[model samples]
Target: MTVQLRHLFALATCALLLGGCASNPPATARYDFGPLPAPSTSSQIGTLIVADITGPTALDTEHMQYRLLYADARQARPYAYNQWAATPFQLLGQRLRANFAQAGVKVLSTTDAITSPTVLRMEVNEFTQSFDTAKSSQGILNVRASLFRNHRLLDQRTFQRSVAAPTPDAAGGAQALAEASDALAADLLAWLASVPQP
Candidate 1:
């Protein structure tokens, strides 16, 4: 082959490689709940330990999920190129601890030496964005919250919060989920206050 023809072939190959890289950009977009409120120091409540949140197999991973209400209301989908920095279950525990601490409620972990302190156990039943239309979606957060004191169950409640997405994309769902999380934290604190302490 001629030198000019060989150079042309090399350029073509390079162009194809570059185009492939462009089309298949790395799936590196990572989202997480932002900074939490500072711990409060005034009128303190007794310590509460947060247990690891449990959930179904689908939600056990870091994949960000959504339901397609427009196509199939029962089907859930994970974004191909988007993901949470951590699983929802794990994030929930972290956020709850932060929220409780900020409300002047001493937050403890399972690793603490205390044996009978109040415990907050949560089962995440549903956590996903559901798209009703191509242009709109809502973040749905559902959890069964149970409080234990002195090794006895004190109170249990199911909390559900849905927040409208500003857009129909994963970013919108993430923002909505964050808002719903804040709402859930507030609701849980109120419920805990009303429950009889051990």
Candidate 2:
């Protein structure tokens, strides 16, 4: 073949290779939380009084990016951002209410219902996020909770759960966080059920 034709062929091959690399898209990750189990029949029937959740509170901030190192010594890089619906205090309150309701307990608001037989209050101790790099992901949530009754301490507990994206994307990270929150809710409910009734 002529040198001119050979040169043209080489340039075409290089362009094709570069084009393929540029068109490649990152993998997408998704998460689906299975349905939660119902409360056990052994839970007690009582008036559930939920007081205002006092904080030092923690909230799901807008999603951000972080670096990840794969197991193969390859750098996966970072991309995308995410966020959550409620703060830690808000999440705890909602979960407590839902779980108690499922147990057939009546809920009493402090403003409208003052005649409740018992009052439940909670204090948040810790809520923070940490990152994981080996899994090509960004964060984990840790929390500590305390329970009270009529201004007296009833029980205090700590909870920790890992939240990570299935893929390095904002939506996936958000989904992981939400799933972690739901798991926290379930754990809190189980603890509440075990509390002695007044």
Give each model a TM-score.
Answer: 0.87, 0.55
Which consecutive 10 residues in model 2 have the weakest lDDT in total?
57-66
* lDDT on C-alpha atoms for all candidate structures: 0.85, 0.57
**Model 1, TM vs. native:** 0.87
lDDT of each residue in 18-101, candidate 2, tens digit only? 999988866444322324356554355467677766654123332232433333323322333233344545655666566567
The superposed Cα distance between candidate 2 and the true structure at residue 74, in angstroms, equals 24
For TM-score, the strongest prediction is: 1
* lDDT tens digits by residue: candidate 1, 30-66: 7777877454333245778888899898899989999
- Assess candidate 2 and give its TM-score to the true structure: 0.55
lDDT score at residue 184, model 2, on the 0-100 scale: 66
RMSD of each: 2.8, 7.7
Give the range where candidate 1 is weakest over 10 consecutive residues by summed lDDT.
36-45
Please estimate how well model 2 matches the true structure, expressed as its whole-model Cα lDDT.
Answer: 0.57
